[model samples]
Target: MRIAVTGGTGFVGQALVSALLARGDEVWIISRKTAQDRTGQERLHYATWQQLEQNPALLEGTDCIVNLAGESINQRWSAKAKARILNSRTDAAARIAKLVGALRQKPATVVNASGISIYGTSDTKTFDESSPAHINDFLGSVVEQWEESARTIPAERLVLVRVSLVLGNRGGAFPLMSLPYRLFGGGRVGSGRQWMPWIHIEDMTRVLLFCIDNRDIAGPVNACAPQPVTTDQFGRAIGKAMRRPHWFPVPAFLLRTLLGEMSSLLLQGQRVLPAKLQQGGFDFRYPTIESAMENLVGKSSKPSV
Candidate 1:
C-alpha cells in the first residue's frame, strides 16, 4: 500500500506514518517544508505543498490519503487564532480535493480527520457514528465545515474520522495534561462530571489503518474508545498511572478567564463511541482508561516521562 499524508510531521500524522512504514507501506508525506533526513529510508518520501502544486504526480501512485492538517487549537481563542483554526482545516481539505481532482488515478480511500465536538457537549447523551451532528460551539462549527469540505474529495470511499482526545506520552496534549499529575496536583477540571471521550495514540493509528483496509466502512466514524470517562475519572486515572495524588482542582472560571473559548475543550466533552470500528471488528489495544494509562505511562515505573 502507498499512502499520502498531509500534516505528516504532526503528532497523529507522525504516528500513522511510522506505522505505515513499519507495515512496509510506502508513505508520501505532504507538508510545507521537507527537511527530515530520509537517509536509508527507501519507502519514506516528503513533498512540500509547493512541489505538489507544481506536480500532483508526486503522489500519483498513492493508494490512500489521510488528511490531518490543521492549526492547533490549544492556544487562547483570539479572533485571529479562531480564523486560523477554521481556515487551516477547510483550506487543507480544499487543497486535497483539488489535488485529487488533478490526479491521473485518484486514491480509492480518503481518511479525513474530523472532531468529536460535532455532537456538542453532553453529559447525558451518548454519540456514535449514526448520531446526528448537533454542533453548538466554535470547534463544533469548524468540524462541521471541515467535514463538508472533505466531502468534496473524489474518493470512492471517504471516512470522516471524528477523533477524540488522543492520549500519548511523546508529543500531544497528554504530557501537559499529565504534568499536574506528575507534580502531584491532578484533579478534576470544571464540573468534574463532563465526559472526556478519548483513545490511546496506538489505537488511534490502528483505527486509521483499519479504515483504509476495510472497504465497506465509510462516513463519520468516531475514533474514540468504547469506554468514555468523566473528566474526574480521567484525572484520577492519570494520578494513579503516574503514582501521584489527584488533589488539585482548577476552577472552571479560572480556565475560562485564561483560555477564553478554548477552555470549553477541557471543561466540556461528549460521550463518543467508536461504533463503526467495533461493528467492523476493529480491535482496540487500549479500550479502557486504565488500560490506556497503563500503556502510556507504564506500570510500576515511568520511562523518561
Candidate 2:
C-alpha cells in the first residue's frame, strides 16, 4: 500500500509512520524538510507541503492519506496562538481535500486525527459516536471546524478518530503529567471531578490501523479507553505508578490565572466511551488507567505504591 501522511514528524505521526512502514506500506511524508536520519530508507519518501501544493499529482496512486498536521495546542492560547491553531488544522485538511479531489483515482481511505473536545465539558453527559452535543469552547470549536474540513476529502472511507489524552512513553501527555509525580508533587487539578478520558498510545495506533483496514468503519470513532476516570483518580494512578503520594492540589483559580482560556484544556473534559470501536470487535490492550500507567511508566515494583 502507498500511504501519504502530513504531520508525519510529530509524536503520534512518527509512531503511525513507523507502524505503517513496518507492515511494508510505502510512506510519503509531507514535511518542510526531509528527515536526514531517514534518508536511505527504501519504502520511505518525503515531500514538502509546498511541493505537493504546486503539484497535487505527487500524491497519485496513494492508497491512504492520514492527516495530522496542526500547530501545537500545549501552550497558552494567545490570540496569535489560537489563530495559528485553527488555521493549521483547517488549512491542512482543505489542502488535502483539494488534492484528493483532483486525483483521477482518489485514495481508498482518509484517516484524520481529531480530539474528543467536541463533546465539551460534561460531568453528567456520556458521549459516544451517536451523541449530538456541541461544545462552545475554544478547543471544541477547533475540533468542529477540523472535522468539517475533513468532510471535503473524497474517499470510500473517512475515519475521524476523536482522540482523548494519549498516554505513552516519551510522547503525548504522559511526560508532562508524570513530571510532577516524579518530583513527588503529584496532585489533582481543579475540583478533581472533571472526567479524564484517555488511551494508551499503542491502542491509539492500533485503532488508526483498524480504521484503515476495516472498510465498514467511518465517521467519528472515539479513541479512548472503555473506563474513564476523574481528575483525582488520574492523579492517584500517576502517583501510584511513580511511587509517590498524590497529596497536592492545584486550585482551579490558579490555573485560570496562569493559563487564562487555555486552562480549559486541563479544567474541562468529557466522559467519552469507545462504543463504536468496541462494537467493531476492537480490543484495547490497556483499557484502564492503572493498566495504561503501568504499561507506559513501568509498573511500580512495590505494589504499595
Candidate 3:
C-alpha cells in the first residue's frame, strides 16, 4: 500500500512510519522539509507542504493519508501557546482537507488524529465513541475545532482516532512519567482520582492501521485501552513495576501553580472506552495499566524514554 503521512517525523508518526516501511509499503512523508521523490530501492519519499500546494499530484497515487501534524501541547499553556495549539491543529486539518479536495484521485481512507479530551474531564462519568463531544475546557475546545476541521476531508472513509494518553517507555509521556518512579519518588499527582485512559504505543499503531484497513469502521474511534485506570492507580502500577514506593503525594495546588491551566489535564480526566474498537473485534496487546507499565519498564535497566 502507498501511504502519505503528515508529521511523519514526530514521535508517534516516526513509529508509525517505521511500522509501515517494515511491511514493504510505500510511504510519502509530507512535511516542511525539502521535497524528495522515491529513490532507487527506497519506498520512503518526502514532499513539503509548499511543494504539495504547487503540485497536488505529488500525492495523487497515495492509498491513504494520515494527518497527525499539530503543534505539541506539552509546553506551558500561555496565551500564545494556547493559540498555537488550537491554530496548529485546525490549520493542519484544513491543509489536509484542501489537499484532498485538490486531488485528482482521492485516497480510499483518511485517518486523522483526534483527542479524547473532546469528551471533557469527568470524575464519575464514562465516555465512548458514541458519546457526544463536550467542550468543557481548553483541550476540549481545541479538539472540538480540530475534529471539525478533520470532518471536511474528502475521503471515502474518514477515521478520527480520538487518541488518549499514549504510554511508551521510549517516547511520549512514559519516559518522564517513569522518571519519578526510577528515582524512588513515584507518587500521586494532583487529586489522584482523575481517570487516565491510555494505550501502549504498539497498540496505538495497530489501532491506526485497523482503522485504515477496516472498511466498516468510520467516524470517531477512541484509541485507548479497555481497562482505563485512575491517576492514583496509574502511579501505583508504575511504582510497582519499577520496584519503587508510591508514597509521595504531590498537592493539587503545587501542580496548579507549576503547570497553570495545563495542570487540569493531570488533575481531572475522563474515563474513556474504546467501544468502537472493541465492537469491531480489535484486540489490545496491553489491555491493563499493569501490563502496559511492565512492558514499558521491565525491558531495560534504564530505558531511554
Candidate 4:
C-alpha cells in the first residue's frame, strides 16, 4: 500500500510511518519543513503541504491518506496558539479533501485524527463513538471542526479516530509525565480524580492499521485502552514505575496560575472507552495501566513504591 501522511514527522506520525514501512508499504510524508531522506531510507519521501496542494498528481496512486496535522494542545491556550490549533487541522483536512475530490484515482480510505477531548470533562459517563460531542469548550470546538472538515472527503471509507492520551516509549504524553517522577517531584494533580483515558502508542498505531485494513470499521472510533485510570492513579503508576513515592498533590489553583486554560486538560478529563475498537475484536497489547507501565519502564528490579 502507498500511504500519504500529514504531520508524519510528529510523534504519532513517526511511529505510524515506521509501522507502515515495516509492512513494506511506501510512505510519503507531508510537512512544512523539509526532511533529509529519513535516515537515508529511499522509500520515505517528504513534501510541503503547499506542494501537495499544487501538485494534485501526488494523489494519483496513493492508496490511503492519514491526516494527523495539528498544533500541540498542551501549551497555554493563547489566542494565537488556539488559532494555530484550529487552522492547522481544518486547513490540512480541507487540503486533503480537495485533493481527494480532484484525484483521478482517489484513495480507498482516509483516516483523520480526532481526540477524546472532544468529549469534554466527564465524571461518570464513559463516552464512545455514538456519544454526543461536547463542543462548548475550545478543545471540543477545535475537534468538532476538525472532524467536520474531514467529513467533506468523499472516500469509500472515512475513519475519524478520536484518540486518547497516547502512552509511548519515545514521545506523546508519557515522557512529560515521567519527568517529575524521574526527578522525584512526582505527585497527583489537583484532586487526582479526573479520568485519564489513554492507549499505548503501539496499540494506537496497530488500531489505525486495523481500521485501514477492515472495511467494515468506519466513522468515529475511540482509540483508547479499555482501562481508564484517574489522574491520581496515573501519577501513582508513573511514580511506582520510577520507584519513587507518590505523595503531595499539586493544587488546582496553582496549576491554573501556571498553565492557565491548559490546566483544564490536567484538572478535568473524560472516562472514554474504545467501544468501536473493542466491539471489532481488536485485542489490546497493554490493557491495564499497571501492565502498560511495566512494559514502558521495563522490568523494575525493585518493588513499586
Evaluate all candidate structures by whole-model CA lDDT and list the values in order: 0.90, 0.87, 0.89, 0.86
Q: Highest TM-score: give the candidate number.
A: 1
TM-score of 3: 0.96
* Superior candidate under TM-score, 1 versus 4: 1
For candidate 4, which ten residues in a row score worst on lDDT?
Answer: 296-305
Which residue pairs show backbone clashes in model 4? none
Candidate closer to the true structure by lDDT (higher is better), 1 or 3: 1
Q: How far in Å is the alpha carbon of 165 misplaced in model 3?
A: 0.5
Count: clashes, candidate 1: 0
At residue 237, candidate 1 shows an lDDT of 88
lDDT of 3 by residue, 1-305 (tens): 99999988887897788788888999999897785453453889888889899999988888999999988888899999999999988998999999999998999999999999999888999999889888889999999999989999889999999999998766777788889888888799988889999998889988988987899999999999999999999999988877889998999999899889988878999999999999999999889988887787764434322
Using lDDT as the yardstick, the better of models 3 and 4 is: 3
Per-residue lDDT tens digits of candidate 1, residues 50-144? 89999999888789999999999888999999999999999999999999999998999999999999999899989898889897999999999
Per-residue lDDT of model 2, residues 1-305, tens digit only: 89998898888888888899889999999886645654577999888878887887888899999998999998899999999999999999998888898888899999998989898888888999899858689999999999999998888889999989887765666788888888989898999999999988788888888988899899999999999999899999888877799998999999999989988878988899999999999988888899877766655432210
